[model samples]
Target: MAKTVGDFILERVQGWGVNRLFGYPGDGIGGLVAALGRNDDLEFVQARHEESAAFMACAHAKFTGEVGVCAATSGPGAIHLLNGLYDAKLDHQPVVAIVGQQSRSALGGNYQQEVDLQTLFKDVAGDYVETCMAPSQARHLIDRAFRIAKSRRTVTCVIFPNDVQEAKAVEEAPHAHGTVHTSQAYSEATVLPQEVDLERAADVLNAGKKVGILIGAGALGAADEVTKVADLLGAGVAKALLGKAALPDDLPFVTGSIGLLGTEPSDWMMQHCDTLLMVGSRFPYSEFLPETGQARGVQIDLDPTMLSIRYPMEVALAGDSARTLKALIPRLKRKEDRSWRGEIEQRIARWWREEEERAMKDAKPVNPERVFWELSSRLPENAIITADSGSSANWFARALKIRPGMKASLSGTLATMCPGLPYAAAAKFAYPDRVPIAFVGDGAMQMLGVTDLITVSKYWRDWLDPRFVVCVLSNGDLNQVTWELRAMANSPKVPKTQDVPPMSFAHYAELLGLKGITVETPEQVGPAWDAALRADRPCLIDAHVDPDTPSLPPHISFSQAGSYAEALVKGDPDESGILTQTFKRVFS
Candidate 1:
């Protein structure tokens, strides 16, 4: 008997070890979803929006080291999946998006919400293929989809036509979906750099000149090896934003992050180190980096694409960071760098203390920065935090003063939206006992199905219940980029005048069977926070923030700031007293 497309998909997913899929029920995939319903080994979770579903899938993929799956109908549903898919791609996550296409006959011309599905998605999916009339070949198609997702660590789209979804059956074994590995092949021999290159690198370290190592996310699992390399070579280490948790900042040789958002030690090392070893980092900040005349830079990456993509390197080797360091350990000669390491250490310590002081000193009504800082300080050593992209990314990155014990962090690519909630939820799912905070911005709140908040409240609740508190910085509008655009449109005429309608996200939470609290003043924030930490149910803290308050990032251009200056003076041509709120929010 020929197997139905539905049976083929189930067996294929089971074969690829995908037991859960983040998706929603709609007219497009009714047959497919129903078929999935009968499979006890697979789980189908319907999300509020396609973006949220995709995000959940991405997080699941990241945490489990497997290709996370999300499904959506064609047209609007498939469109929404792009944001998360883009995020997954940039973050190097394995994601598979199974989108239901309209009937084959209706695809070419606009019947209703028709789009050329294949053409629309080909560019987006790093790897993509469409199954036209091959219902019998569904198993192989799904298998190839999984292969693309894992090999490229990218989002792969598989468009399944609707008519053949519910045909027949196939006999399958349970073992197919039980074993899968997301880890790539890393040859040990690849670890041994050419003797000539190793000697050159070792000679520089042994020369007694100051050396520093900058690590990125690629070095996450190699912290111990990095430390071993540092110990033998007397090198100090700092990380990039993506690499913040790669090593314990408390280590005497470990400094903080680099970039404009980076700490003093990172900046100091870029300037002082005569020889720099960058492990698993593709830092594009050429301005902060020294010219070739001062310091020779070395980099080790598993992917060859990273080499010469941005800054030129004195040496670039494709190898496993941990194994490569281990191989180089014996070849490296130890050198004394007490003072060199001490200087960077002092700067890291000062930056840590200064950030704490800065957050503590800013006690005011609706200070979003202060909100982030306090949360970071109060979280336990092993707390896991997920930050949404947009204002939340900057606000949290700048304010959430992380100590060495932070266990996990997931960030969006530069300025996207809709990841914070699911990433937080997934982290909570991964480690139920740890306090997971979803630091979100109001703009992206509705985009995530709030119903998931109920899922969180039901299974994971408080200190004893494994808390998942969503702290939404509420400004009622997504002003992340538009504020700057408005400022840049024209020169100052006097402050412009505009006001967004008021919104109460807290009330929305109350309806979801979860504790909801809103704080507009600094005085009430402390207690609100305490209640959330201690609450026996999942909670949401709607923090009414000043829209004008500059996020202390993007370092708003002088032109934009001046333009904003005039916009405030005008004060909507209606509301006059609100000028103080705008100026203090942005300029201050």
Candidate 2:
């Protein structure tokens, strides 16, 4: 029996355990969509836009660690997927992108919706990108996409021409017993650094009087090993934003986050430590790291290129995080110093107090920090929170506490907006039993989040647990960009481009057959979340946050202060208003 190229492609992807797919149907991929409809095992989710579909795919991979798949039509539709594909590429998530192309007859003729996908997607799909020129190559191309995506943990693309989708000259079943290879790449295998490397890493760490730990997304499964190592070394742990949930925030010495969104304890601990143990993190901010010669370091990462890239290392261990840590543990020595750990605990306590004080500030509009703090207290222990890139990122990094069993992610590397809603929707889709929440800023919620809200509405019944929440931090501004402009560029205030019209996200949700509530006062923040969690359907909470409130960094620089002063003298309209709000916050 022979199969259409589309049939063979679908069979190959489904064989890889991809039951869910996100895509937008169009003339370019109509044959592929028809092939998809012929199968009952695969659920082809129709998204409002190709961009959201790509984001949903990336989020699916992030939450489940599976090869997320998405498809889009040629030209504009395929172009729309670039941003979301970059999200997966930068975060090192496995994703397979199936792109539609113009018919072979129309190739390079300036036909409608025709694009040279191979060239356009080269950067994102660095590992693999192939156009199925013949029906016989369909299975091989699809196999290569998923294989490369999973093994390399990056984006892979398969371009299917419109004519090829209908071509019938391929194997009927690519997953048949005789055709498949039983290789270890298709299964899990334990990986660890060499014994000598592990021993050297342990020795470097053990020799230091004061040690600190920095963890990232690569440390997700090695939480216990990381904690044990930190305990033995009496070291404080500072998590990269991508590793926020690697360890429970309640851990005595775990500093919440590092960089501009870092806690005071994290900044101090990393700088003061005599030695550092960096596991699975490529923390980009060198400023937050210890001065080059200030501390000796041991770096552990699966990618040899990533090891010791950020900081100079005394020892580099390249392998699986959990396996390497387990091997190194026996070689490690217990430190006698409780003073460093004690000081970290004290700083942690003080940071919490300061955060609480800020959270309780009585500004005319509700404080953004309060929203995260309230959500932190109210969120379920197993909730999966997805935050958008903006001021909300800072608030979540500093204020939200990730409890054990809970998972959270953001567009950490891409740092793009509009992924919050799509990410939450995908989280709910992947783990229906767990609560999924999206914490987004007003500007981001307006950008593409609102457009993707219908995705939640569309998939509400698919989940066994019907609870999904979108917490809109409605401050009517790109709060994060505004601060960056003021602090870094010496700008007066948020530019007109950064400001957005006020939106009632709650009303929008209500109109779409979901629960929606608008909370203006700080007092209403807690109840809004409570109501959202208890609601039977998807929900949105539009919390009116203070636009004048500044997302001040943990450490303020002299240059930033000077910029602020210069901006005020240049007559920013909001300067007096922000000053008054700050005064009220400090006093009240």
Candidate 3:
């Protein structure tokens, strides 16, 4: 007799440290769910939707540095997962998606819940596979899932055939066989370019001009190296938002974020610097790139593939950030460039001061960014923050300053809507003692299933005073896309979709038995967030926002703008509606 595929899945998942599953189960996945129920080590999440399940798993994996798992049945359930998978891939967030297949006997017979599960996600998932015999292929699929989840840091889906899931195992119990490999990359010392390359680089730095370092995601673990190299070369730090946590935001050598949506200081610094050191960052927006009249960028990355992919570069060097920075640190002298660091420091201080002032502002509608910053200040050290895309994520990234030792997870792409609630749930699942705050736009919260907060509340409440601060900015539109469209294309007035109406997130939250607050005024944001965090269970602060005040778009190239502007000016639109839209924006 052959053991069932579901049993083998549980056995293998146990090896990968997967104790719980996240998802909404349908009839197609029943056998697997039953198998999960039988296994003590593996539990099920029971999310409100399949998309949220994948998102929760993605967030869990990002913070825990392990494979986070989610599951769903066939057809529409499986379809819901693609959007989240796209985001996980771009951000390199680790996740495993286990979906059900139509019974094996139903293959090519026009089955009810049928989908070519493996092929459907081939383009998006780093690894796509299906389970067969539990003793052999099932265990092997588990290994593949873990590998893709770890190496590619993206979603890996295993479609379990219903009949195969019910088959008996040849062995008394199934065996799981995924293993973790911890190999270190070794670099052999190479001869330096005889002081000439260093001389040129040093000359660029020592010139009587401003110098800056632009940071990105690749510098996460190499903050010290980046800092040391900057200190030795007298370069100021201005990081991409994705690299926000790379170093202490309050560091004296720091300016701020540089790009279109960036602070004024970051814009000034990027424009003023004569030499720019690109360390482990591959920021996509070209608008933030220093103009040709200003600074020239020198990119340093682990892979040469990232160089010149998005923006033009003066030089591209392939090397580990820390190792390269270590080599460069000693060769450079540490003399101040007079007003260079001082000017940046003053600008940063001014921004910080304005941020402080914003914290004190009183208005009819609370600013979401101001609320996030306030909530961040009150949270305990090392508190987890999971943010969805849109205004909420932008505000969280902008306002929730990353302290050196603290951990965070935010969607680095724009594929999914409501990842916040599920992400917070996963963070709590992994570290129950450390409360995780999930920030999301109102449009996203509804899309994600906020009521599922009760599911987590059921098991983890005893972790004591459950502090999952789900701050929902309720302006009722997908503001991130709207803002981008306004800038990228001359779309007149913000377009309104008749697909959905203004939603009440606060009402829905309380219906789920979680504590809730409505922040109609800015004065109430801090107090509301503080109260929610102090509550002993799940809570939400429906922070009403001014929909009119949109998050500005990040910078990009003038050529791209010229193309769109020409389309607008030449009265060339694909449709009358497009022309009408363009007219609205032009007038606005």
**How do all models score by TM-score?**
0.84, 0.96, 0.83
- Please give the lDDT score at residue 496 for candidate 2: 76
Query: Please, what are the lDDT tens digits per residue for candidate 1 over residues 1-588?
Result: 355676667767777777778887666666578777667878676676787788888888765677889989867888888887777877777888888777776766776757677877776685765654445456555776787777667788887767657555433323455433232222224445677776666666677478888888778778888998887766778777667767865677776666655556677787788887888777777756666668876778877788655556677777778877776677777676577777777777776676665554433347676787677547766777777766676656555655555654555344466678887776665556777788787767765636566556544533355556899888755656545444665422222332334567678778877788999887777788889988777789999875555544323447766766666554533223235544444445
- In TM-score terms, candidate 2 sits at 0.96
What local lDDT does model 3 show for residue 146? 80
As a TM-score, model 3 comes out at 0.83
- Please name the candidate that would achieve the greatest lDDT relative to the true structure: 2
Tens-digit per-residue lDDT, 297-340, candidate 2:
89988888888889999898888899889888899899897888
**Residue 289 lDDT in model 1?**
64
Q: Rate the local accuracy (lDDT) of all candidates.
A: 0.69, 0.87, 0.68
Ranking by TM-score: 2, 1, 3
Give the CA lDDT, 0 to 100, for residue 155 in model 2: 97
Error of 3 at 445 (Å): 2.0
